[model samples]
Target: MTQDWNNIPTSHQIPHTRFLVDYFIKLPTQVTAFFLTHWHYDHYRGLGPNFQQGLIYCSPITARLLERITLVDPQWIVAKHNNEPFLVEHVQVTFLDANHCPGSVMILFQTPEGSNYLHTGDMRYTPDLKEEWKILNNICLDAVYLDTTYCHRRYRFPCQEKTIQRIVDIIQNSIGRDSHSNEIHCTSRHTLYLIATYGIGKERIMDALIQKGYRIYASPDKWKVLQCLEYWDSCLLNDSFTTEPCASPIWLVGWNRVAENVPGRLLPNFEALEDMLYMANYYRNKVNSSQHGLLQRVVACIPTGWTWQGNNREYLQEKDHSRLSVYGIPYSEHSNYEELYHFIAWLRPKQVIPTVSFSSSKRQPKHPFDHLLAGTQVKRAFLQKWLNNNPKESCEDDDKQSTQQLHNQPKIARKGDILSYFKASPFNS
Candidate 1:
């Protein structure tokens, strides 16, 4: 399971992401362990007290972050690092850096039956990640659980570097306009630039801003989380920031206010960001027209892959006001359709299953895409290639015998399999 919003471990009535966790509690599913790919809330939020089935594992950094933020104890979440393979109930599990977010990982599991499975948890395929997967050439991958968040044809985006440059350009242009404005009565006022960000996953953009000498300000809780990330990569953030909006040129705003558009002007935290229109009105009312010029302008930029509308990257404006501007940049944490296609081609798994899925109407992987087509072509190609490579194992065999074949096949000879095959293996101990 990748990500589930509900924290109910026992309740089977939840999203598909929690299916495995929920199923384990209802039956003797023989689930030996629960593995977390990253510290994203959707991935680990459903973990409740009822989860006593197996050992839970996450990366060292993810473990630290979870412990600090949530009720998960340090002992409950075992810390695993990249390239370290451990055995649990005759299954060999290896962790690799996901290159998506801090402490994100991809898992490789080799069963005693000699079937190999690779599950990429919320990853962006990079050159470094490509190099890391080279270690798996010795073992053939039977199946791959891929992150196909942007599997559609329209999700063509440039590299992360280009997106970063685009973001920087937007900020610079806004500042340049303010600098070069020819107002008769000019006042020294700061423009409120809000960058919409989730809890994690935009550290690179922050690093770029920090490099250009901009301090990041967020809620106290989020600031603590940023501090934890800063401990790992010093360039990712700054030590100090102010909560006051006018004090900083750039503010890291949470997604709740802008996304939900919650009413009553109540911010979640004392320093929480509220509606930009409301804030703009507050500033506008306080402005002294007789004394000087414009008081403040609020600009909100959302960095996401859904910026393209009919093959062009443009900003879609809100209806209420002109001062409150929202721009979507072509920034993404997951691989696009072309990248996903190429990644699948490179891995050449016998079977490929998308780790993430969406309803027919909802294109929001996190947020909605302008035009989302269920790109069956990529999957068709994979299926065709897989069928060509392994003719003996047809789709019929895949449908009827895949799970049973994996479990019931003759166990490969190992040091402890003969002694502890039926009983609990000594690997976890």
Candidate 2:
């Protein structure tokens, strides 16, 4: 299983098999191994005391990170380099670097019966990646477990570089205006830049901030993780606004804080309640005197892909008041519709299973192969071939018939002639 940390099984419902990748659900079964895709909390949080039966497998970088987080027993972590193939219970598994986050990987599984499967664990697909990962394009896979987060037609996100540059532009523009407006009191007043980040996904954004020479104020917990991850840049500091009001420009906050309607409101883990209230009140009073007063107080920048859902644009503009402002930028780790299509077109798997459950069957479009397909794309060419191969039954019916045929076959073969067996089933070896 991949990305199933949130689905912890209760005592009533327990899984039998124990091979998992990045999912930490508790079960009664004996664990074979824990294959982690990355070091994200949602993916790696299953490493609790209740489930410690198997060896933990992850990339080297992710292993180093897990050591600092204090989630699971670090003694069990075994770092596997990318592209190295390992054997586990007669299945040959290989890992390839997934360009989603640091240490994220695409796991490929090969069985002894000459069947191959690929699981893309939260990745952003590109033409260059397709070209470089030759195994993905060269072989025909038996099945593909795909990341369908943005598999709908409406999702078209800009490249990561462009989005990062735009965010930097917004911060720098605010700083430039602050320097001009508060020149006389610049030494006394400071701008509070609230960067909404999940612990690991936005490291690239942090690198960008460091490149731009912005000092990021990190909490003790986040600071420890960052230090263990070896992000020993000069820009990361430990100074709160209450301690030095004019000290830092950027304060690394949480994702929940960015979704808040009011800026400078006291968030639980981001900062002190009194400090935030003082900053809010101080900026509200200073708005009349300084042109960049709103910028000086607080600006909430949320890096997420949900910017395209519904009326987010209107909400962002409406929330832009005197003290606090909210902006959502398109910075996603998942592949979009076009990328998913390209992956399907290239690999041409026999079956495509979505990692997430479908929302509403009524909301989805219906086609001839609606029940068989995974995403919105109606693979017409594949459908035509499938229909030609099985003319009497639909894909679902064909699956049922095949399964029934297997069950009905004799378990023990009588002394049958090899020639007769070969002639009876030409496809069989």
Candidate 3:
């Protein structure tokens, strides 16, 4: 939920249960179990080495991170696998992959009274989510606690793989080499690539470059966290302190070291870039490489969904200075507007409760998917149209239609056709 750091509200508590997800500050006495979605600082803020709270439920990777990074008591932490149903105080709860980070999950709660609730803690919705056990089983949801971080229509961007490829292309092109070639040759000695990242996320970009035979330099603290992840390749990472500064052509810096993201603008952080250039030049001079002059060029790429400028024409935005250039690539771990729309439409939950706040004004902004919720006229009309169009169509006629139109038609023409229509719609694809 949209939590106020100063005073956390009771809205984080699930209905008909004493369990709390991603809320750990000044917890109530009635809390019997704590649920952690991931190892991000914002989600596990109040947890510490001295915490004496009850057991915390999370994924396996997150459990490892807690033991190593936060040093939370291992006795109080319970690790669970994805899609496994377990009883907590006689209530069945399951964890599903949230697809946001290493150990993020979407929690499902089923009570004895036949009520179902889903708490999606910072998730990126994908088409494969439709095949999850809960959705495939067609369980009637009582309420859905959704993550509305990028609920606006302007927040749409390309998929994660596309964005990663774009960043790799930028790096390869800047280094004066063909991206598809196995060999990378750069004539300029002053060129350096900087990738801005967070503590836990953005490993996909690093892994992509590593697969291309590029060495990356990271700090010891960052490397420690990376070792906890299951997919990290230790051969490609270099300890920054032990190795020379210019040993690797690419360096991973903090998120704010490349660009400063404000409300509606992203400006290059010239101060941080200047400091990096100075450090690189100093290290080069110490080693006496060619006894030459200082470096001149540095290219920094900041990957985030906020870089999207609401224009389909501009996938990558650039800003140029005299010696440094910054490129903001639209790489996000959160679902965009269209993804959110398709997910909600397919789930068809009875009621939706947004867990994020988008505005600071007295009057909050309107939700973008309000029209697609239950009981709305738009939903009614869409279901009605689907039922009327495919009432008595024969199997041969359905096969005769084009694949695009066939995806729009339901698989079976039955009494309650709305469910089949939604299940077979192109949006789910």
Q: What TM-score, over all chains together, does every model reach?
A: 0.68, 0.69, 0.79
User: Clash number for every model?
Assistant: 1, 1, 0
Residue lDDT tens for model 2, 25-72: 553355576677787776777565444667777887788777757456
- The lDDT-based order of candidates, best leading, equals 3, 1, 2
Residue 369 lDDT in model 1? Answer: 16
Candidate 1 global CA lDDT score: 0.58
Q: Which candidate wins on TM-score?
A: 3
Which candidate comes out best when scored by lDDT?
Answer: 3
- Local accuracy of candidate 1 as per-residue lDDT tens digits, 354-376: 56543343222321111111232
Ranking by TM-score: 3, 2, 1
The segments of candidate 1 whose C-alpha lies over 4 angstroms from its true place after superposition are 1-30, 48-53, 176-189, 230-246, 260-295, 318-321, 361-429
In angstroms, the error of model 1 at 421 is: 38
Which 10 residues in a row give candidate 2 its minimum summed lDDT? 418-427
TM-score of 1: 0.68
Give the runs in model 2 whose Cα sits over 4 Å from its true position. Answer: 1-18, 28-30, 176-190, 230-246, 260-296, 309-315, 318-320, 361-429
Pairs with backbone N, CA or C atoms under 3 Å apart (clashes), candidate 2:
24-46
TM-score-superior candidate, 1 or 2: 2
Q: Which window of 10 residues has the lowest lDDT sum in candidate 3?
A: 418-427
